[model samples]
Target chain A: MAGYSSPQEFVEHVLEKELSKIEESESDEEILNKLKGLGYID
Target chain B: MSSAAGLLLLALMSAAGLYFDGGSGQHLAYIGPGAGFAFLGSFLTLLWAFAVSAATMLTWPVRMAWKAAKRRRSLKKARVKKLIFVGLDGYDPRTAERLMAEGRLPNLSRLAKEGSYRRLRTTFPSLSPVAWSTFATGVSPARHNIFDFLNRNLKSYLPELSSSRVNKPRRVFKIGRYHIPLSKPSVDLRRKSIPFWKILGQHEVDCTILRIPITFPPEKFNGRLLSAMCTPDLRGTQGSFSFFSTRNESVTYETGSRYPLQRSGNVVKGVLEGPDHPLVPDAGKLGVPFTIYLNGARNSATLEIGGEKYPLRVGEYTPWVPVTFKAGVAVKARGICRFLLNQTEPDVNLYVTPINIDPENPALPISHPSYYSAYLAKLLGAFATVGMAEDTWALNEGAIDEEAFLRQAWMIHEEREKMFFNALDRLREGVAACVFDASDRIQHMFYRYLEGRADGPLADTIEKMYQRMDELVGRVFRYVDEETVLFVLSDHGFGSFRRGINLNTWLLDHGYLALKDGAETAGPYFKGVDWSRTKAYTLGLAGLYLNIAGREAEGIVQPGAEAEAVKAELIEKLSGLKDPATGETAIQRVYATNRLYRGPYLEDAPDLIVGYNDGYRTSWAAAQGIVEREVFTDNPKPWSGDHSVDPVLVPGVLFSNRKIAAEDPGIEDLAPTALELFGLPTPGHMEGKSLFQAAAPA
Candidate 1:
């Protein structure tokens, strides 16, 4: 409460943490590269 | 796409993750309630939440006023005060008709008699995720981007989750052999296109969606939503169970792990595995030690783990057991699982259900507003957070029997009912949709009993399940009035899965698909297949894919002429292919996707959708991209019922309180109907028609 300048800021931070974005859509090539780098696939 | 630009973009994403305060990236199901905003103590966090809640209550009037101002004129013109959708995932119309005629499902008969019952056309594949995605978006799989449970990765010739992806954090700090994640992991819902609920919310119409398939990583909307299918367990897999047994033999299952149990007299000990260790890099799966005392005289056992004890009886499931693990410097990851003790006199065998993400303190966002799941957990107690909660794989593996699976399925059903009714009780206006899975799970495991047997322990399970669903509808009717419109629907119907058709094997025999030299059989993921010469192959339940020159990473067939020729060849020969054992045609039809759908993602659809005949489906080995020697095999697994067949033969059922005007309403129409009822025009991208008058409900 002390860190927040206003009540709205505190609420926004809480909701952002709670309902944060879970994923971003990538093209097949990009997804493959990322997965490959993670050693998920050869 | 230069290499330097690609590297820069990746670095920017890592920086963005750090800037975003990313939570639960690849290592999902780790953070728990009271752990977030971790700089503050738990008590301080509670104080913060209370302060926020107090502010919300104090400013409720202002928020409501602002919402009213933002609402469109359609809010006042909405024809219905409430719209309730009851989705029974795999409720077969044929079985429903039989039960209704036999007076076994009286409430369903009442609903049909009062309003109307129609065979709703499902999607081409007739799978839950595909059909339900259509139902939500008012579009086909091409537009919704959900064709099956697994979609093939063109680059690796491997299968990836069709609906979502979890990417690990990019930034990490290392010191003294310990690594600290600077940015949190992320989980992304991959299904493209917007659902009807979001449209309704934009128009200021509230929606409370519960457990709809393909809804994991719940989208932000105007109302509450709890995700369902594709929600991974704490271990970040769909649903992986653990079996601890005293047997010496080692065995493996695609969906679960087996651990050896060491016993001395009455005391038995085993290691229960959890998620990957968060702070330690290169460390394998995390484990927590467990001890069990077998009581042969009493035929019961006492199990202890993580500073808690649970008493387990034979053929009965222990209540959800909390299994906590050390996740970080001070953070602890929590998960819950149920244990079913098999036999003790012979050799102690225990089955622990996949450790579900704790609903109250979930590591992943299973519900929109995130706290909604925690609120429900507090209100209703612990509920299963893992998608596919019934554990059908355990039953199929013989780790648990039919009766045990039924017990677990019913428990989940009851839990869902409580939440659905709670939504109903709280709903003053707008839509409340809840989909129950037991109707699908029980039918999948017990439909074979209906095949040839007259009487058995599980012969009547499907009928009983339908009756229960009917009873659930009866309870839901209590909330309906002239101001409300009610709809009961199934994503797709069910059928027998007796004969497994290995499409890859068929392709191999016809030389459409090829194997490596001296390798007559290919292992899972098509390990022994020679992709250079292979023209076509099948991976997902949807159908077969072609190796086009410009499309696949390793392309052999040219796009314009060669691809079309290969597709035509496969379609001509594979259609009406006969099974040698039963002499019945395995394939009913083969649909070229280009003719079936037109959209931006049409290329994602399998080249050909093989419509299986009744009692035939993709074989167990073939579904995983394995190449078996034979084309047809017996489906020996207990998962004997299926809906992945010709869509026309397995049309889902839709019963409503008002008559629908459309002659053939499909699963996609429901979304357009919801939008129309709320006095909002359906989006131009949607391809479904309004089924009833907007003014009828009132």
Candidate 2:
């Protein structure tokens, strides 16, 4: 919550937190497999 | 990354027909109202971010110097360094007093003893939206232009979202079957007066406002804010949950949609409805196909959606799943929803939460600065973005049970706590405020359990929520120092909605409202009503509109003296209405809006606001503009409690860490109080005084 100088730095920190959750829950391979099933990716 | 350049590229690519295929011969795409805006909005947001960053770097020294000068001037006569408002929506004074007497609410009782606790006067209708609007602007509903949750479209005679209005792009480029919108859609915040935070921002005071009602399409100011009530889901509705089941029953729900799924062996397949496909002409709502693999022996399932598989157990909810709806080759709208596995063995039933605009890449502006929501999502992971995040409608419709609903409510509460604490920890000066709605939602659904003696674990649900909120207050108290001023308050209190009074039915029975010939029951929005002959009608939770000349589309009653006479007659007849079933008075009084509100927008207010007696409210049918056969009926829905009664019966509780000399402080008083705390004078248009002041010499 503190020590961030700019809004961009603050935003990047938040993005890191959000992206970490996605990585923790499901890997890229799992997402790709599911996408293949839905015809979103080959 | 300029918006003009982006629009030019879109036009050129669309003209080239790059993504068009010979699927239906027409290359027309239909984007849902919200999805189209999201695509354009996100692009513009990115461009704006880049511009802002560059501008900040260029003017860093000048900005810093200016801020220092402004801060010195702003804090010259300040009383405190920080002011915090903790809003517990629908926290009743009576309930708090009872819990304090029992010594169950230690923190609140201690705060009351040390400072001040009193009953805060609520708005006429005692509604959250109306009262909170008053709290933000220091004005009545007439000045704020928010009388109820819904307002009638005078032209169409249909109920529309009152606080925010979204308008589609009027000008479009028509090329063959494709209609490309050349202009961006506009979303307007309809609340009339300026919020106090904006005034505070003008004086260089930093404020972090979280989940305050009527703040959707967050206004630009020198502070941060996340909107609350009336913020629509990704689908451009308040909140619409999807229930997938294999049952043959076709039922209708007030707020949610049910999709019948066909199960084959152990596999059940269904399509999750997404935003409309923007590139396809005449295309209905877009759908994301999903597959559920049921493990009947284990009572578990694996739901495969958007190329991701989530494990779900019976009575358990899956974490939010990010969904992408593709409209064209490069056009995709992002949203998120959670999945709850309701049943699997006898009949497969899966519940999908309302698709909230992904905070990381929001479709609409749900926070001030536009990037604030994205920053929160990046900071704390994804959270509920819809204003009314709790699925009260799903529980009321019997789609999800009480336990499932409670879990959802608590999860939302946890998210709010994170955001609230984040603000408090970061903000050393200025104002920090956040409102928790679980207190309101839980009591609305669990008050019935308290009325009747039951040994079920869920019977103590309301009491448990109160205790949890008390713990939250204790945490907040620990964070506050002498330099900070804290205020904990609610917009209104709660009362049981045991019986419903259909005002339309009463009007029909009393010959005030007339329907078309041969119509026994009037449909929603008064479809069967012959407005030419109709004198009055009831449409929202508490509104009663008269068909007056020069106002209504089909005016019958004249305005001025004639309208006054009609209002008087209706009020005299409607007041003290009784329910035959229980032989109890259903309506306590009826308020004439003209008399209660004195502002420019008084004409827009409903002619009469029904103040129902405790334990009674406007029926579901009446709220939807239906004239039912019976005037009185039992409210068997899970949403068994409400505060839309007489304002006197549901006075909200207000506890301040600082002593307040004022008695009977209304919600409107808080806005001016916040200004005065910051050493700023209240605006001339504001109609409220500071709560803390010295007594006059006797």
Candidate 3:
């Protein structure tokens, strides 16, 4: 159990960890505004 | 010509529409002025958007389930939860050691003490594209098919971009005077082998790769990647800056174009050329006119482009200005550029950096998933999309001063750092990697300053850049946990390019290469060379190709034994060649492709790869096949540092958070090592070994 025996187990472990985090998706307009603020886009 | 007259005409047209044939006339009743066309276009756009959104919404659950399943299956044999690769392109091990010994780079020294650091062997040519291709694919340059940035087309003997090929759309519809492309133009990534991320993605391991060289037209896999190095500007070249001046000098710059601007009453106008119009067959390169209005009192200027005005102070760079080229109705190509007001008084000189493909509206594919670049643009605003974004050529040609060049480099570095940190924050269990080229670019432009030979104001630039990179490393260390493994490396080290050896002239002088009658020298691509009598030719950074009978168009040397004998003779004679000025050996060794490479594409490689000693490299003219008068000349350009020397002399540096068992790790080793770290077996096709353990397939 110290290391994964197959790729499937590793995926499950990663999915479990990913599921624990909060997910947020920003809209295109919002991303553009942020970029403009950062002086990367005008 | 008047609004009232237009309205009257529209009214007459509306009345005439009612007289059209029977059933068709009923449909035509809704056509008034331009409303019908606008309504139809908006309706179609809305309909398509609705359909796509509905489909995505309905399939979201199923797609999520499938991805989760795939991820679980791929990560089943995983060993590490997270892997981070921090690439400092062209970071020199010798300089790092010197600084570390002098107690200048504390963070790197601490990292070395806590974990491990060693010299990482580079590829044969030690070029960025070749070395990074090997790093990504875990193979030699022959296997990856990226020998150099420029590869000669044997048929025409013209040099072309090696990593990617962009072809115009094959099908077009001609209507009256307009030629509209009926299909999307295709961009092909020419690097042959699969990148390590694709292999990892197949195993269901998610990856976020940023700005890796030779990844232009990024390949599709289970990852997000931003392409780097070899990505062309909007004008379809590596990097070409535009210089506008009022000085009546017909000077030709090596890497940039100088245009004479006509000034009338404190106003100067110049045209900024973008990519070719995709919809027009013979429209040539589309150009947008810009005007600079000089203000002598304040020593400032106002730049007007595309109806927008920006204030420009002398010796100051304007922010990224978006430029649009109109191709046809509803067709516009966008790119971004920065302008520096070099001077404003007696001779107005303005420098415009090459217009990079706008990440928000890229004219060509610059990332995978197609939307990945757009997403990053949205996230970080607009960042550099052109490969080799630092504008070293501008600095080399004296179009921009040292301060301007350094400012541009660090600004790009800051943008890369933002994206890198964002990926790190998001990747909890997958791979996140980014390569910072500031170290490479700064070293390239400032090594002469560091060597105490050049009289420049920025002598400590290289040291400052290294310290900044160390700070970035320290920041990375703070973000990783026990489950995370970090790897910091460079593609190759750097050395001073003091002298340039024009191998073509040398070959011409030695009677190995031939020219036409009454022609003592030739221009680029051996224009005047008589190929029938020529036995050898040199093109690219370190390539020497023989005029083999079967392979070349006008080859004189026979293929089998005769070619081998010629190669042997050249190699023996060229190796250990000395510089007459200094009496120091210039070339260390000359390697035959057959002996150095063992891949199927070995035949496409250069017949001989030259390995120059430190402080020596191929001259600028020689790289383009130009035969100069002298065989050797002092390198006078600001690009005073280089790595296209003997591979042994420019070994890259590698540092890791974990102990590496391999005594001597090469750039190729990192790809296989990434797979091993994730508990996946190294594929049989890969020529590299894992640095941690023997993960060869049973």
Candidate 4:
């Protein structure tokens, strides 16, 4: 948060960090869903 | 003048003299002695040529017409309303003799005593596919090109399971060499090959062939045939029929519905009912609990799952009671669910018999190992790459449970026999050629009995299996009558093998076989091969070839000298290799490829064909194997026995109600004899002479 210039940027950075952590802890099914959300599959 | 021309001139002068003299005898004196003698010689030559031409012209067409007439006469005499050919595969005469002596197989024994029995000499390799193909084609293996189960890949020096057709080019093309057609003809048909069934069919005999092995993609014929490619394993498919009933009301179960039951709540529960579907209309009785006897059906309907259709049928019968359908109760169903409902639109409470696979003996989970012996290592190896890695030393020889395997095999044997005997009872007409494979399969797995391996797993069951087969044979004899001609045959005989030699491996060691860049893959020879030193090599089908000059692609061995030298060297080397324990010769015979293989596909056979001693056999995939020890071990697997040696001793039995002379018969003579028995003329084209006259006592 300290590295970011604006509140919005700081919020975005924190959200991205949390998302990566969540992905790491996700199961195969959850990861599949994430990939589908990214348009990897129909 | 030349002798031939002088003779021609003299004959012409004499003809002119005779013609001028009005065909009178006085013209002979008028021509003078010299002219008369010359004319006589020329006339004799002319007569000879005319006679030869006339004989050649008369032979073929007249013979063919006579044969057709004979076949017709035979059919008429016998008035063959129906003809049945029963093929009992791998039935040994020696065993039959023993069984008869023991008072077992009473019916078969009686048939043998009353009927004429003769031993059939099977085609070379004596393997099932080759022998059965010959039985179908009535031709030798050489003509049929079905020498063994596997054909040799000349380029790779590897063996592949032989097919009815060649998938790859039989020979490699070389510059400036004639493109010789080296491919073997397909075994199904040949100009000379005459199938016995085709003859019967031509005569308009209605025949039904049941369960003859290897008749897949059934041949085109007039007869109605249910090709028995094999006695198919019926455990997985839902071939059985089932039925269901409801009392007083239509309990319509929708075309597609799920019925689930839970202990908490459900409807009226009763025994699961009748055949899933009615084969015979009105086969089902109207009762509360329908009694359904599931007789196995060959083919049936399918179930729709999601957007796709699943080909699942009810395999066998399972008893189930109707349960009240509810949402909570349905959720508990692990497997597929069926519904039981009262009459509604589209028959919601209708009795539906859905076909499905038998849940109990589904397909066996056994898979042949991808790499022989290597799979055993991978399965046993427990550790990562280390010295003789833990996994490498590990052996998963199926937990080494020999007894369990034997028991399972015996159980399968019992079921197979039951099905076979039952099928025999059902068939009233048509050919019933049933094959009993238990004899062959069991022998392979349990030959250790004769090998003095006491207290083996099958010790108790082996004799029992034999006794059971004898009983089954007895059962078959009961149904057969004087009209039936039973052929109990074996493709080949079996013997004990002590050692196996990998011909490819041996060649690689001796540098006779060249490898690619230090790799074991067979590559282009003569490019990196040293032909000067290599004397002998071996390949499949016991084919041995010499490095003859002008014959090989790169012939370093001089023509005449090399052939003899190579043959002698090979014979000495192969014959010298003996089993360490037995000190007996490992190889009994090594035939030269050309000498043995006269078929067009001889080029595809091994260069040096080796016939191992009675007890030994080349491994199934010998070329791809690593020859670590000289002879690592004898066949220690489940298939300890093989029929690659001497032919099996099964003798074919022929019977007829009509009194005929007793004469010795060969397999080839069967067709001609059948024709003669029917009072038909034996076909001139047929090589087999008739046994009719001899059938009568002298």
Candidate 5:
């Protein structure tokens, strides 16, 4: 828990370090939303 | 110790392989059945400690000269020589008024009678982590970035601990079914914004902060600190106790570990679980074998654990017993637990407290100077290092009764009092603040008795808790003088949780949330969720999230106009929602996060905060990301009280031994107040005015 002097510093660390593993996979659900939110009823 | 000195000690410890106790922040895998580790580095750690002492001794004069000059300059304009803050978590103002009128809380009443008392405004969503973070940083929840206890890992749509993150060991050597970690897990604090203590530290103001929630993995500062809430136990869970029974019936308590005692001729045996095997992921948990020999009369027992023997009296708790879990050759994870002999007659029913991470040989970075926790353990005795060590859940689950819970909570309280008072005596200057959770935990478990929901022998528990806190304040009065400023406050207040409002179920019913095909209900973490069709959903206790396209990984709703429209619709429909069972309004208000907060992290905030009415809270199901079939349920659990509601309904109580102050104060204001008392200007980004300072001429 090293001290961060400010929020900007913490944010930079998060975006550049912690969140470097951004997902690239696409969801079929997102495509279904484009087709008028079709057939998602359970 | 000073910040520079603390950093030096931390470096020495890190160099000596005592860097981290395995940064398993809420990672339950490591603390499965038995695995605790330390001895592999104990000799090196000891050697480093001596070397650092010698190095510090040699460097003292020059370092002292520099620090003394900085302190003199910082204190030149100081308004007070010393500032002390006593935090009584969840101490309600309404209850205090009633008890003070009854002459039950003499010390708090005296402070109000002689000085000042005000209803302190708590943070939005009214949670300890959020409220205490604001108190520490003098900022909005968006600024501190601790809006809830659990955060949704957007990629997986699962809940993870929000306060801290412990990355897994990066480098490992695999050999014959074992993965020996070559690197320690990198532990990081997730709470944003600079705490006022860090600011004070920059000004050469030494402070001691103790048991403040959300401060796990204590950061380096120009002061001493012992982490509090969010510090997990050796089993890497929040607080999971173990129960050994001989009923031969398999019953699982949600919050406890259940093990059957092997009984043969009055000799019972059970394995005490520790952390997972450090070198082998699939090796299960490292365990310690213990034997309990029942007395001939079958009323008492003698317990043997960790190569030591102690007599266990019926319905009595044994002193903290040290246990070592062997992970590998020369590798051990040390921990301590208290055994309670519930019964020994017909069967053996023993309750073992959650194994707290050994303070003397912690498996995590729980203190600022690194060795400060061990120092305290050496000075005092082994104290509970697990966050939420009071184990309210054990009482709620009926694993332990009222008396046992009370005894355990009070024992932890005494341990805290010792450390707090020690800090006060030694802190002749700078700031010293300590938060006591007994006030919060006792009320959470016993508020039912106050509400007359369940008649119990400990009906007067809440009053007794308030009295105990008052006695504590009276003791603290002795340490305060003319040059010292004492301010006592609570993060939030308490209320009965009579009904739980499942926002997820409501969303499902309202067609805002959709499940997968053939699914009528979702398991924990939204197992059956259709993320795209789910325009609006809820997770965690205090928030409703919108599945905006760019925000969440599987989001469907478009940001801006579409998201706002969904938020507005949910707010309109949910506000003042009535509970059909109780025939009462369950929700008081709905707050749009964008309107409520303005900061860098506002986008990360929950889209809509559901401010339930005083007697209502987010259902346990909703908090765990489960979509149930029903919207409301009567909360029958022993944890009958909470503070997660409209902030206005549960303002915390504040008492100060000073004559003049603002008519109202807030958890955030205390940070600026502490800064102003030290004659330091509050940072411009801080959204608080000094409580002791009046408004400027408009």
Candidate 6:
């Protein structure tokens, strides 16, 4: 049986796979950590 | 399957088979009954041709993916040591080119010769905030939701100025990982937008940012940054000691004091006291009094007043000395007193400090703390102790003359420059974008030097300013190595506007609009206009739009009516109407924002637009009537130049010591290119393509 019920869900799943293809996908926590290391405090 | 369905299935099956089989397995094949086998073979041949074509079409994405991956891998192999962004706000290319030909800006000229330069296309309304935001976001105004310098606050329906602090809420927030505790609400780090440096920081690249406009209370990040808030009260010298005593305490503390305090040399050598000076006479000299010791001579007579004994040094430049006093001592005696130095005369005032009730838990001193952060904290704490407005520490200068204004601006610029260089030197993987507002500020203030006709007008001063900017470009290029890419950017270009245009009156005159309350003295577009009957409305930033019901509260234009027709009519009417004096058409081209905004962001845009004729801008004030009879005339007052008109051709300059493809690159491409240079992933949200990947110049 197919895991996804709809085309939109299927498209999203495929897109996520495409995104993960990159070695270092961006994360919010990582971005925030990087900014902090730079000395900009919010 | 039906014949059609069967044919489609056959086509899909063969296409998938050929695509999966690579190249060698693309030959025709037939396995069917006797006579039809020959026919099947013919169909197979056609099917094979179709499959091969499909395979070729499908291979492009794979190739693109491969190339992108290869480029990403190659970029990872090398690293960018430094990245510097130089912003020349409102730098006109025509003036720059003329100066370059004259060989005035040798530094900038050298950079142009060594790197790639192209005329950049500025955004609509062509205002500073709009263009600069576009440069920062690498997206169009519609996408970024910053269409005009002033967007109408929808709920209020009031035309907001770009400079108004009220528009701060709609402003995009840039949040980094660093958290700075502020009295005001901490900045929302969750805003959904990414800046170039933030992206670089994501990949562990550190950046130092100096004086970029619109960033105040700078967000937390991995790099050092001095927030560029170009307010009047910048902390130059926070706290300084002032000696109070009897004598001519002529003190020239510093050249640029926010406020001038009086002092004389006699005060230092005279009676000096601290609040803690002992009450008992002869218990201790309450405070030491000495003659002003400068240039090797005692300035004047001294008197013993408070604790601490110090001998006077006369007529010699002496190092700074502190005079201490015991607690609960009052020496009330008339003596010549000086506080501020350098004045022929000085003012005297009582200096006092409150005693702590509890020695162990003494109230936090409001006086200057030894540390800068501690001083700021104490100052903030004092505000709570005695309810004071946030602006209590604000610096105020009374009525600065033109010369004084220029001096102040220059001083600010110098400090900003230090902050810029400091940040640029430390950046590793990220692009360090720094904007020098001095160029724009100076241009706005002294454009009269170029455009002014009366009293010592400098000829071609605008061109000279451009030359200065070119030199700045040259200075920035020195930081980049062969691998580092550079971009010289501007928010918008500048032009001279003679007169302002008013569109409101034209609508009223044409009977397409109506007043709000049928009152005679109702202001135009001010609460009285019946929007239902109004076919089109023109605001300061947005030209005209049909009042469609669901779309707009008072939309008058019926749904599905030819919007182009109304736009065409408006354009024709606006174009035909010429200024009586100059006879120039004020309306340039009524561009549909959709046609121009092709990148990611496009929601917030004006419906029907009107670009003014070059050298003409809208008025400084809105009450100046919507329709004016005159076409061209000298500008009214205060501001001599305006930006609503078509700005001069402005180009972003890109430089590399290495030979680069002489191809045009979009500003958005900069972020991705930086990522590629550092071997980091360019987020999918980024729309810019790398220039390095573009084919080399012929």
Tens digit per residue, CA lDDT, model 4, A1-42: 221223563465457445534332323322221111100001
Off by over 4 Å in 4: A1-42, B1-74, B77-88, B93-96, B117-119, B154-158, B165-194, B224-431, B454-457, B508-577, B592-609, B620-632, B646-698
Candidate 5 chain B least-lDDT 10 residues: B25-34
Model 1 misplaced stretches (Cα beyond 4 Å): A1-42, B1-60, B69-72, B453-455, B693-698
- Residues B1-698 of candidate 6: C-alpha lDDT, one tens digit per residue: 34455335335534554311112322211100000001122467778989999998989899768655754554465456555677766665655666678988676666677765555666665755556555555555554445553434333234432221210112222223211111121222111135556555544565655545433334555444433321111001111123342344344322121222234443333444322111122233234343433332323222233333333322221111223222221211111111222212233222111111111111111111113222322332211111010111111111223343344344444544554555555544456766766566555544555566323534454565576666666666657776566767666555555566556555766765666566432342345666666776665543455555555545556555566567667777775456767777766666666676653334235665567776565543232223333323465432344455543323434444444452665455655666666666655555555556764557
A best-first ranking of the candidates according to their TM-score comes to 5, 2, 1, 3, 6, 4
**Each prediction's TM-score versus the true structure:** 0.87, 0.88, 0.86, 0.51, 0.90, 0.57
Q: Tell me chain A's TM-score in each of the predictions.
A: 0.45, 0.45, 0.41, 0.42, 0.36, 0.44
Ranking by lDDT: 5, 2, 1, 3, 6, 4
The better-scoring model by DockQ among 2 and 4 is 2
Output the worst ten-in-a-row residue range by lDDT, candidate 3 chain A: A33-42
Local accuracy of candidate 4 as per-residue lDDT tens digits, B537-563: 433334444544454444556756666
Compose the digit string of candidate 3's lDDT tens values, residues B290-383: 9989876557989999999999998888888998776433345668999999988788999998888887766667888878877888898788
Provide the DockQ value for model 2.
Answer: 0.02
Q: How accurate is candidate 3 locally (lDDT)?
A: 0.79
| Best-matching candidate per TM-score | 5
Best by DockQ: 5
- Residue B635 of model 3: what lDDT? 88
B556 Cα displacement, candidate 5 (Å): 0.4
Complex DockQ per candidate? 0.03, 0.02, 0.02, 0.01, 0.06, 0.03
**Residue-level lDDT tens digits of model 1 in B1-698:** 45455345434533443221234432233342112211222466668989999999999999998888767566777889899999999899999999899998888888888888988999978988899999999888877778887787767777777888765665665544444455556676867678999988977888999999899889998889999987877777667789989988778765677899999999999998887666554666678899998866657999999888899898888988988766433345778999999888688888999888888777778999788988898899889987788888877877788888889999888889999999999989889999998998888888888775336877878888898899899999999999899999998898898888888888888888888996888987788899988989988785799988767778798988778888898889888889989889889989998888876567778989999998988887787788888889887778888888888789999999887776678898999899988888877778787888432342
Error of 1 at B183 (Å): 1.2
In the predicted model 1, the residue pairs found to clash are A22-B187, A22-B188, A23-B188, B24-B185, B25-B185, B25-B186
DockQ of candidate 6 relative to the true structure:
0.03
